[model samples]
Target: MSAAALVVVKCGGNPAVDADAICADVADLVRAGRSVLLVHGGSGAIADLADRLGVPHRTLVAPDGVTSRYTDPATMEVVTLALAGGVKPRLVAGLSRLGVPAVGLTGLDGGMLRARRKSAVRAVVNGRTTLVRDNLSGRLGRVRTALPQTLLCRGFVPVVSPPAIDEHDQPVNVDADRVAAALAAALGASQLVLLTGASGVLADPADEGSLLRTYEVPATGAPGRFAGGGMALKLVAAREALTGGVGSVRIADGRVSEPVRRALNGAGTVVRLSDMIPSLKGA
Candidate 1:
């Protein structure tokens, strides 16, 4: 598949972000003859499962305001079960119902997504900045694009998620948005769409109407405005994809129907390299 015909989409794990709509949109895109790679997160599901399994679920906010699941040994098990067994099956079934050939895979499968496990993480805990020594988190490294491309060429949409295999052949949790960006960059995808709960990156996260329709990434790879919550990590992912030669990146709403088409038509925050602005990095 040519880069122009390929799109990489990351589906946010927020409960408000509808997976059904996303799968339907993916089906529409594939049916329209576009190559689609779907990457998803299941934070909500993980939390629920952890509660049931008596695992203490904890979330850590990095110094940079990016929130992530604090995956201890027990939590990692829940993440694996929730993402693969719970969330992925529904997405695969939804795509199948829509007649789109979808193959579900984890980063561990075929070493599709590889990362280095973070031995220690710096996070704000109990209002204090501390280094967590036993964090089983992974920062994305190489993304094997050929496997997904082969599936795409054969008319199948590849649905991917964490936990990615680390250098030691261990499954470690990785951020879904970053994984999507890596895949986009590796596949030379022309467009990368991130569908989240909110309409777009808001000037004020509390004010929904304060949507920033267009955001320009900093040329220096520094943080720009609207870097907070999951949006901050998403901004980082967008930067990676754009700098890696992706044609465009759009952060749009997943709650709406036909979200994929809407994003393609410019219904969200469109990011471009020429819109680059200088700003200090956010902590």
Candidate 2:
């Protein structure tokens, strides 16, 4: 199958999102001869396991106000276990039940997803800006596409997750949305669909009726003040996908039926590089 026919879907880890529906949709797509790759996050599962294991779960707010899970050594272990041991298996099994040949993989497998470990992350902690040195997170550096491509060629749907390997061969937490973006770009996928709990990107985060049909991200800075919480990160990932050669990117509601198909059929906020600020076109 041509890479241009490939579609990468990232399923949000929100408990309210329907994973089974997404799996069924993926199975339908596969049967229709469209190459699909599924990426997922397990934040909810991570928190649950952390609670069961008596690990204190914490979050870090960057100076810019973007919040992320604080992955200390303990939290990193929980993340790895929750994603690989919990989430990936269920997704692969669900796909198989739907008659789709599926394979589960982590970024640590085949060195497929590589990153540079962050020694410290600057964040606002306890109302004071500080450098958090114990963070075990990383920023993606490279994606080895051969593994996924080979699997896709063999007709297996690659269900992938994080805990990407870093420079020293250590597992480090990485954002799952960015992982989808990297894979979509690396695979030259025609579309990247990010399914969340809400109805696309809303002008008013609280109002679903305020859903924007299209959102234009600023070329040089953060999306906008309205882009808060996970939406901000999703926008960043969408921009990266568009910039990295994805044909289009959509942020849609994962709660709806046939979410992937809906997004592909224009049911979410469509983001494109051409919609960026004119002055900062190449920035």
Candidate 3:
């Protein structure tokens, strides 16, 4: 498969998502001669492990209303253990069972993902803006595509996840959606599909029928005004992929059969850079 045929699929960490179905779909795509790179999130698994280990799992709500995991030292440890030890192995095994050679990798592996740690962040806590200084989360800085490209060339599906290595050469939690976007851009993939629990980017979160076929993220403001919770971050990731030169970005439901194929065929919300306001394109 050529670079234009490469597809980056991100599997959501929500427990409702069917990982088995996704792996099966990936097998079909590979058999049909499409190159695929899988990136997965493990928030549910991390929370579960944190519970069992007696660690407090918390979330930080940005002023714009986007909520993200508050990855302090303890939570960061949980994130690493859950994704690397549990979630990744399960995905690799599922693919192997379906006859797809899958290699599980973390962002720290071979510096596949490098990030700059955000030593502090401003978040809204109980209606008060607080400066969070100890959160061990990082913003993605670079994606090294050689490792994944080599695997894809050898007919192996590379399954990747987060805990990106920061400038200090330490692991820090990073959002998986952003990871998918960065990889898609670096690989020059034709499509970046983010499969989540929701049907798509719904105009109303309570109604699945209200799925927006296309959402134009504003060039200069927080997309959270249009979407709350995880959807907000998905929109942000979509914008990044589009601006970074990925052909297209889609937010689709991961619970159904053939989720990836459906998204590629336009079953979900599509985001394109052309949709942004022309005057604010570079803002």
Candidate 4:
């Protein structure tokens, strides 16, 4: 199927995420008459700059042996600066230069993304499981659907960053994938393209053949395929979007030409969630 009314994209902050390339790709999508919401991460730069400044970068070990980033107060500040001060504006500027009439805003603006505090996180580091304390992470709550709809209706591309505070007035850092998922569901997006560094979700970690061209996952699973770390969380978020009435979710390599445009035409790891699990069980 062609991309829907709203195409929500998550661009990773990895060096390979290629902001310029991403901007051009989105411009192409817009030129093709598609309404787009651009969401991005800045953690890669945040980590680099934090290390250069001698700030402590923290990771934790989950009981299941997965490593994950733990957002403390300092990290939350860094994330805020990175998202607001850097990522959001830069993309907006580029899109504007490309004649997209883009506008940058934190999820807090007009209550675009109201989130709940995530008090606990699990991870694995240095061969030890640990509970991540002092998590300032956020979960999405109310999505100001009207703001995006208004922006789209007025021909402006809305670029969103790390969410703002909760209604209770707490600023929590949220994951980019979760943001993408929530945006997809809120907009009733036909396709959610997650541009990551990897080729796609692999069936086996070691073999290239493990690449899953299409993921028609069961509502429940055996666990190892997407367990132990961020992948587990991503899979969970994907499920949330799919089960909650979004049409589809795809995780694809972002370094190529027109990644977003390509993803819409079945150019990556397409997770066909609009269908049921039993139909593909024997295939």
Candidate 5:
């Protein structure tokens, strides 16, 4: 029997996510015998849709006061339209073109991604502290392992995204990384790779030398903790995936060709625990 390997890949919905290339890359990986689960984000599309709809997407300030986009119900609607209707099918067709069978699913499907609606969020009300309930975002807590496990066992790849279901059965917004982490944990995936527009985790986004190839995920307190904007959330998600038994989590530039193969073959920054980091001098 061939040893099956589970790999969770998050195709950041940055403008760089080319549906055709991503599908081709995934098909190639499957042909090479790796079971891949694709989880994607559609922030760029959501932003564009928000502009067209005149719905102001709001980024929330955490209780710690860190700022980030918090999806309300309206925003979640945008997520579904982009992720399920657009991105998901594009990827499915892309893989289909390469003769790789793919199944696209969302959090609401068979309880794929589950979480609680954290609508009682904290916010600043005219300079005064206020609680913002009815928030559409939720903390990703669990994923239905059976869904992907069954598909993977049958040699089919599952492509997925956020807006996971909570214990209450509400469809809640979630970070792609968070969903990836949960999926990786459930699938016993050794590698979880995040493909984004910018070069993989850079110490200095402005300098080339600052590119970190193999670095430890620094200890953090919460799910979205790190040094800067999205990187912090990514770091937090990486930590979750690592601690959940995934052997390694990688961040790479998605715009590059054959991104998945490149990431597996050592073409990106590797975020791992100190002991897990390999000496990548020659790689």
Candidate 6:
């Protein structure tokens, strides 16, 4: 890690991904004197908790084919309960075991992440555009860097997550990757690393070896070849971070040992503004 490097790492909430490896990598970085912030989400855990609580989990598909969780009042309650109660603690414990003083924080804490709630969202239902009301999803606004920076000053690794409070002071579900991007931008981080289940962005979703080693992303908008499922939103987040002046954005597999180090060393699809075209060279 560079002496002045500040990095924001987003650990995917997918059950298949090994978050322990990510936390251990973070511990190594912290011990090496790097300032790191870990951003995570608990959608998988939230769904399980919702099922046990008899709360139905629903997803809305947008016109552009992107699917997002339908965060009604009850679902938002489940989100808050599961993310704060279940996921954060495990991550904190894992980091602590690795010798890093990890402090878990949600967006609702100290107004760490302020957002603007979307009153409603347009979705494609049965091949038609429909309005879904009372959606508790939000777009992130100002991020309070002081809390995390203060944690850094105190030699603690800040493990942060969503349920960002909106202008109305209501907790709203926000995308974790986007939240990481916003936080990285706020801190002027040297790199933003998004760890996922796959090795990197694949030319074919089913083929791991088809990893596109480098992608030249625009400061705005999504590129055509890399658009699909969760990867699409990650692309959007990458654009946000790159546009906000992050040095680089990388998406890599979190299941491997030393995942963070591999990502920083270019073991995944790295997106930067300078590359004129996307390159599919093997990593």
- Say what the RMSD of model 3 is: 3.1
Name model 5 segments beyond 4 Å from true. 1-4, 61-67, 122-131, 222-226, 274-283
| Poorest lDDT segment (10 consecutive residues) of candidate 3 | 274-283
Residue 118, candidate 5: alpha-carbon lDDT: 76
Candidate 6 deviant stretches above 4 angstroms: 1-3, 274-283
List model 3 lDDT by residue over 124-145, tens digit each: 9888999999999999998998
Ranking by lDDT: 2, 3, 1, 6, 5, 4
Error of 1 at 273 (Å): 4.4
Q: Which regions of candidate 4 are displaced past 4 Å?
A: 1-3, 61-68, 124-130, 205-209, 218-229, 273-283
**Could you tell me how far off, in angstroms, the CA of residue 143 lies in candidate 6 after the best superposition?**
0.9
Cα lDDT, model 3, residue 96: 99
lDDT of 5 by residue, 1-283 (tens): 1223778889988887665677788887888788888888888987888788777888766554445576776877887787888778878877788898889898889887778777587866567777877677788776778888888879888888867887778777888877888888877888898888767776666764666776665455533222356766777788888888988888888888788888888887888754333233322
Q: How far is candidate 2 from the true structure (C-alpha RMSD, Å)?
A: 3.0
Q: Candidate 6 — what's its lDDT? A: 0.85
lDDT of 6 by residue, 1-283 (tens): 2324788999998887788888888988888888898999877899899999999998887775556889989999999898888999999999989888989999999999999998789888988999998899998999998888888778888889888999999899998999999989988888999998888788888988778887766554444455567877787788889888898899999878889999999798887663344455453
| Local lDDT at 76 for model 4 | 76
**Whose lDDT is higher: candidate 3's or candidate 4's?**
3
Range of the 10 consecutive residues with the lowest summed lDDT in candidate 1: 274-283
Root-mean-square deviation (CA) per prediction: 2.9, 3.0, 3.1, 3.5, 3.6, 2.2
lDDT score of residue 173 within candidate 1: 93
For each candidate, what TM-score against the reference? 0.94, 0.95, 0.95, 0.86, 0.88, 0.93
- The RMSD (Cα, Å) of candidate 1 is 2.9
Separately for all candidates shown, the number of backbone clashes (residues 3 or more apart, or on different chains) is 2, 0, 0, 8, 3, 0
Candidate 2: stretches off by over 4 Å: 274-283
Residue-level lDDT of model 4, residues 1-283, one tens digit each, is 1236778888877777778878998898888888888988877878876776667887665564334467778877777777888778889999988888898877878878888886677655566655666878777787778887888878788888875577588777777777878878988887788887666666655554556677664575522343335555555567777876788788777888778777777765766543343222211
Candidate 1, residues 1-283, lDDT tens digits: the string is: 7778999999988888889888888998888899999999987899889889899987788876777778989999999999999999999999999999899999999999999999889899888999988989999998887789899999999999999999999999999988898999999999999999898777788988877887877655445657787888888888889988898999999888888889989887876554456232221
